[model samples]
Target: MRSRRDDVDDAAAVERALRLGLVGMGEATDERAERRLDRFIAAPDGAFVWTRDGDGAAYVGRITGPWRRDEDGAAVDLVNVRDCDWVTEPVDPGLIPAAVAQTFARGGRNFQQTHPGDVEAQTQTLWLRLAS
Candidate 1:
């Protein structure tokens, strides 16, 4: 059995990871995925949440729209963008725009009601490939 010291060390490591700005998605199972999804929805000021991919590279994104439940599962407005600070030099996180979030909310509502499957709707989902 692991000692108390070992448990403390593990907790410290997880804290450091979160401070490094990457939230742990402990194993990519359906339960964890749903939990992470809830977290994205809970982020204050609509900041993007970063998570490690299968290859150990981190990706950043935010929920650009409201959550909707379909036959497959629940889907939300997803904007897969690079953390601007990581892409460039680090800067103050507070400088990020709150206005941009409104645009995302409007887009998501309009898309869901009017054009659920339009080809141009793909543009609504932004995907930026970050440089390693």
Candidate 2:
């Protein structure tokens, strides 16, 4: 469900909207959104996250700080954000794991955990390579 208060970037505003049923969401939808938000908030520091920009440039980063509402991010519709140490270069498409590539191809707004045991192993290997 699209937030009715999309223009309001603060977490408080978003919470208010959700709690007040102002976003035109059914109970189940609101619960799902809350769960997603809670997961994001609970993500530990140093966890890796992969994302793509509007132009489809892929990036990977390690979360460096807790989640917060950043008004500056409103322009990109990413008000709820965490500080991250993003890799300086865009991830080379060829190096992206099949699982991750598929995830990106599917395209969803919320963050999702990449799956399959092999994908985790592949990501660790890639992370080590990038570190060196």
Candidate 3:
């Protein structure tokens, strides 16, 4: 799998996002999206998890925060955090803070994580960066 996939003018789109410091869901999964961008899909319960397998996604990534859908689109409340697969919804680029935006920009990572559900097409998954 590649790093990321952007069907549109990704270079330009990412550039714009960098200048503004934000991202969009559509842009989240386009080209090598699944490999690059991963998120935690919370269950109906209040609890949340990281690994897509052990808990959420087995051997996938970590879960960041809660899920909230609003004018900004689907979004997750990310606290003072770093290095983990965060929750996501449709989001407004402007709503995202610069620091969080920077985290997303950083690419090329892999970690010991789990995969959620079975081998499905759209299983709630999160991105993982392997540790050295």
Candidate 4:
């Protein structure tokens, strides 16, 4: 549940983000990340999709997927990093990745694969520390 956070300065931001860039965490020790990704895809149809970093704080909604509709309406390669979950409350409607959402929406694609995206997003992995 890696949190998406930023530092006081952009320099700090870049450093922080780059440090853990694709270090492969969460499921690092075990295949937890892979399993989590699998579980995310296995959720009920229409269920949203997101990834929590190893530290558990950094999460970005999988906006686009491996295949996405380009402006021309044709399937084209997309960055697949459009997470809009923060738009609303406990969870917003359309905040999840459009492609992932489509699977749930259409009840298709038994498995949703996680690709490489959002490397810089790891700058400040959010680790929400609840009060003791």
Model 4, position 57, has a per-residue lDDT of 30
For residues 29-85, could you state the per-residue lDDT of candidate 2 as single tens digits?
476777877777787887777765435666566677776765643443445666666
Error of 4 at 55 (Å): 16
State in Å the error of residue 127, model 2: 2.0
The ten-residue window of minimal lDDT in model 1 covers: 72-81
Poorest stretch of ten by lDDT in candidate 2 = 19-28
Question: In every candidate, how many clashes are there?
Answer: 0, 0, 30, 16
130 in model 3: Cα distance from truth in Å?
Answer: 22
Top model by TM-score, which number? 2
Total residue pair clashes for candidate 2: 0
Query: What TM-score does prediction 3 earn?
Result: 0.21
Candidate no. 2 TM-score: 0.71
lDDT of each: 0.30, 0.58, 0.29, 0.28
Which tens-of-lDDT digit does each residue in 1-132 have in candidate 4?
221222223223222322322111121123654564455434443223433223323233322223221232111111111212221112233344344333334432222443334322321131121101
Model 1 alpha-carbon drift over 4 Å, by segment: 1-40, 70-132
